[model samples]
Structure formats: structure tokens, C-alpha cells
Target: MATPVLSAERLAASYTYHAYRQLIDDLQAEGKTTGPQQSELLTNYTRLNVQRMHRLDKTVQLLPELREALAALRKPYVWLIITEGWCGDAAQIVPVLEAVAQASAGNITTHFLLRDDNLDLMDQYLTAGGRSIPKLVVLDAATLTEVANWGPRPATAQQMFLDLKSQDLPFEEFSTQLHGWYAKDKTQSTQRELLALLKSL
Candidate 1:
């Protein structure tokens, strides 16, 4: 079997980062989110995610090493991100990705696709047998071949989540601690990991 590739038509139908952000905002205004299921909890998460994204968009600063790696790119890449508005991890990480692509100085372009709307694609990039949001599929611009991928969360964060899960903590408690970790880390772990990823590529 061949490695599945994203069709150009699919890429064309995906949202730009700005458009994705706006879509989330628009949905939140209507007390909704980005999937088939609708509920107050999801809506509240969507609202909170909007705020998280807004803050990261304005406040995220790329590390110098990551900035250099991004700036040194010789070829262009497309970062197709799988995400949904109600996802807490996506809220914490997507804006930082946009910031990295923007700093790439045309070497990277980003497109966003909702996981629910793109299950065929999402299934190909599952993390731990689960459809994890904010999963990135980096594609070579010319060939549309996948080059590298990263995401859902940094390794440390993922470990923390797994540890919390092992303890059988309630969703509310674990989520609060996770967000607190993100706030304290301030994107450093994410930046370092991506910096290494870029160097390897």
C-alpha cells in the first residue's frame, strides 16, 4: 500500500489560520463550537479557547534557535493542522504554530482543518490510537508529500496528562492542571521540540 497523500482539492478547502480563528469566534457568538455535538460545556470551552488563542496570538514569542531554523528553510512547506475549537490542547498550541509559520518568511504556509470534517485525513495521523487535535502534518510545498509532523502537546505535557489519567482524576481537575502547566511553560517546551524537529528535517 502507498502512503496516503492529501489532495490539492482538500488543501484548497481548508481554512487559513486567520479564517479558522474567525470561524471559532463566529461559532462562539452563536453559543456553539466546531463539531456535530453541541452542549454548554463544549460551548464554554470554545469561548475559553477563543480567549486562549487571542492571548497566544499576541503574546507568543519564538525562541531564537527555532526562529533561526525556520528562517533557514530552503524550501516551502505547508502545515496542515487538525483541530477543533473546543479542544483545550489545540487552544494552547495552534496560535504558536501560526506564529512559527509567520516567522518562516514564506517558507511555511499553514492551513487548518477540523478533525470531525476531515476524519479520513485525521485517522492517518492518530496519536496513541486516538484522534488527537492540533496534530500537524507538514508537507513539502511542491510535491505535497508529508515531510514531518508534530503535535497534540509537548512530550512533557502528554506525560503529565497520561499520569493524571492513570490517577483517574476528574476531567475538570486534570484540565485545570494541564492549562496551568501550559501557562507556566509559556511555549518553551513546544518551541524546543519544534526546533529539534526542524533541525532533523
Candidate 2:
């Protein structure tokens, strides 16, 4: 028998975008920034992502290509994202995803699930055999069938990470370099890749 598929409906019922944002806020209120399982570096990074998300949520501009693609979407879909408060990549990407879902104008809705809390689901969407996070699993709301998926980071960023990883850079150095790339890119690469993914669906 095939492995049981987790339903988008269940995940969405567990956590919506608003709930995820609130989770961050609650963490910040408790003088914590990262998830229970993460390190101090992730704490600081998570704080930055919170600020970034707020700024991007207000000012992130969707490229014309993404806008047009979203406009052409007739079928409704669910963007079920697996993430956690400590995930720096999720902090950067989730806001942009929310922007995309908003631009879809009722054609799409976004949801969130903490990676640790949803390991069974995350295992199915792992990045290169590791439980790397911020995976976006797009599904048909009516059937809970996957439409498309994208995650962790844009291709360019992922490659940069891989290159640095090959050198076995220290965690601090690796994070600094990775975040530096994210700062410079300003999420353009992410938007471009997600647009392509959506268009293909």
C-alpha cells in the first residue's frame, strides 16, 4: 500500500498565515526569537526575518510576469508551507509567498505548518534527504492533490549554499554569507522562481 498522504485541509485547519505571524509575535514577546530547538544564530536571524517580512508585506512588488500568471490562474489552490519560527529562509520567503497568494485574488490561499510538528509531512517533502525547511507544497484544494512545489530557497541561492557547504564553512560564516546573499537579492530570485513554478502549474 502507498504511504498515506497528508491532506492540505488538515494542515490549513492547523495553521493559517495569520496564525504563523502570531506565532512569531508570541515568540518575540517571550524574549525569544527562534524555535525551541534552534540556536542563538537562528534567534537573531529569525528576528531579522520578522522585520523583513513586515517590510516586504508592505512593499513587496510582484513582477509583471508573476502578476500575469496569477491572473491566469482559474483553479483554486492551497499553498501549504512547512516552516518554523527559527527558519531564516522561511522568514524571508513566507512573506513573499503571502504576497503572491494575495495577488491571486481568491484563487489561492496560504497555510503554514511547523516543520517539527509536521515531520510526517515534512519527510515527504525533504530537501536532498535532509529535513531542510520552508518547503512550499501547492495543492488542489478540492482534491488535496499536489499541483506544484518550491522551497527552501531559489535555485541560485541553493547553489551558493551548496558551494559554501562543500568547503565545510563554520556555521556562523555560512549563515553570514547566506544571509548576505539574501539581503542583496531582495527576494527577486525567489519571486522569479515561484512565478515559473506557478506558470507551469
Candidate 3:
């Protein structure tokens, strides 16, 4: 039998239930189940909050490129998931990532980093204009050097910024985009680069 490729949907679902389970446990432990304080917050379903119990249930399916991403990452990898508990993007991407890690079996060790919790480490990347949560920083497990980084920022910009001082690089329009990042490319270039990086590895 051939091994199955871990789809993003499955990952999302796994993460959802896992997160929900924790929430439930916490609520029970704290006995704080009331109004919006607990109910609304509980309903917010984090990145790992909900999973389709039945396969037939209609849910957001994984995009093709994203599926390709899981395949790109080989075994024995280290993944740093730097994210905020409330960031929408983090909730959106975590499940897919979890699914990928799960499918890979013992090949990957995922380290979840809450941005607020790791201010010191985040400070390094902050200089590179990394102010957002859920940055999936992929690095070499052996050397501890960054293989590449992916998140809310452009791959080229992030890579360049990591490799050189901010002043050395021509802080061009990609520069201007940070102020209005919505106008920038849809991260397709970044994803493509990630794919290439994985293939090279």
C-alpha cells in the first residue's frame, strides 16, 4: 500500500479537535463556563479548533499548491510555528501544518511558539519587519541555520533581510509594500520558493 499524502483539510480538522479538547479541559479545570467570557471565546475555534467528524461533511478543502507543500518537506525536519493565539491567519494555517507533520510521522518535530511568549527570539526577526504571528520558520535541524522562512512576509524580502543587514539591500518598492502589504503579491512567489527550497533539500 502506498503512503497517503497528508491533506490540509485533515490537518486542520486534527488541530481543531486537539485545540478544542484542550479548551474543554481548561474550562472544566477552571469552571469558568459563562457568557462571552468563556462561551464566545470557546466558539472562536482556534486553528486547531474544529475538524469534520465525517468525511462527507463539506469543509474548506486544501488548495493544490498547499498539498504540494507537504510533499516538499522531507523527514527529520524542525518547524517553528510562531503565532498568536488570536491571529486569524495562524488559525487558518496551523491545521494544514499539523496535518503535514502528522502525515510525516516521526520525520518532523514541530515547535509551537506563541509570539507573545517568545519576545526575545522574535526580536531577531522583528528587525526583518516580522511583526505578525504564525511565522513558520523552517530551519536545518543539524546546523540550526535557517533553511528558509515563510509567513506573512515575502520570501525574497525575508531571506534577503536574514542574509544581509537591512541597509545593504536596496529597500525598494517591496520596501514600500510593507507599509501597505495588501498591495503586494499574494505570497505565490514565496510559496514557489518554499517548494524549490524543499526540493533542493
lDDT for each candidate structure: 0.91, 0.83, 0.49
**Candidate 2 global CA lDDT score:** 0.83
Compared with the true structure, what per-residue lDDT tens digits does model 3 show for residues 69-154? 66566557666666644444444445445555565555565666556555665665653465665577665655445666667545
- How well does each candidate superpose onto the true structure, as a TM-score? 0.97, 0.91, 0.50
Backbone atom clashes (below 3 Å) for every candidate: 0, 0, 6
User: How does candidate 3 score on lDDT?
Assistant: 0.49
For all the candidates, what are their Cα RMSDs to the real structure?
1.3, 2.2, 11.3
What clash pairs does model 1 have? Answer: none
Best by lDDT: 1
Best by TM-score: 1
Report the Cα lDDT for candidate 1: 0.91
lDDT (10s digit) by residue, model 1, range 60-142: 99998898898788988888899999999999999989999999999999999999998998999988999988898888887
TM-score of model number 2: 0.91
List pairs with backbone clashes in candidate 3. Answer: 15-48, 16-48, 16-49, 16-50, 76-107, 83-134
In candidate 2, stretches whose alpha carbon ends up further than 4 angstroms from where it belongs are 1-4, 33-41
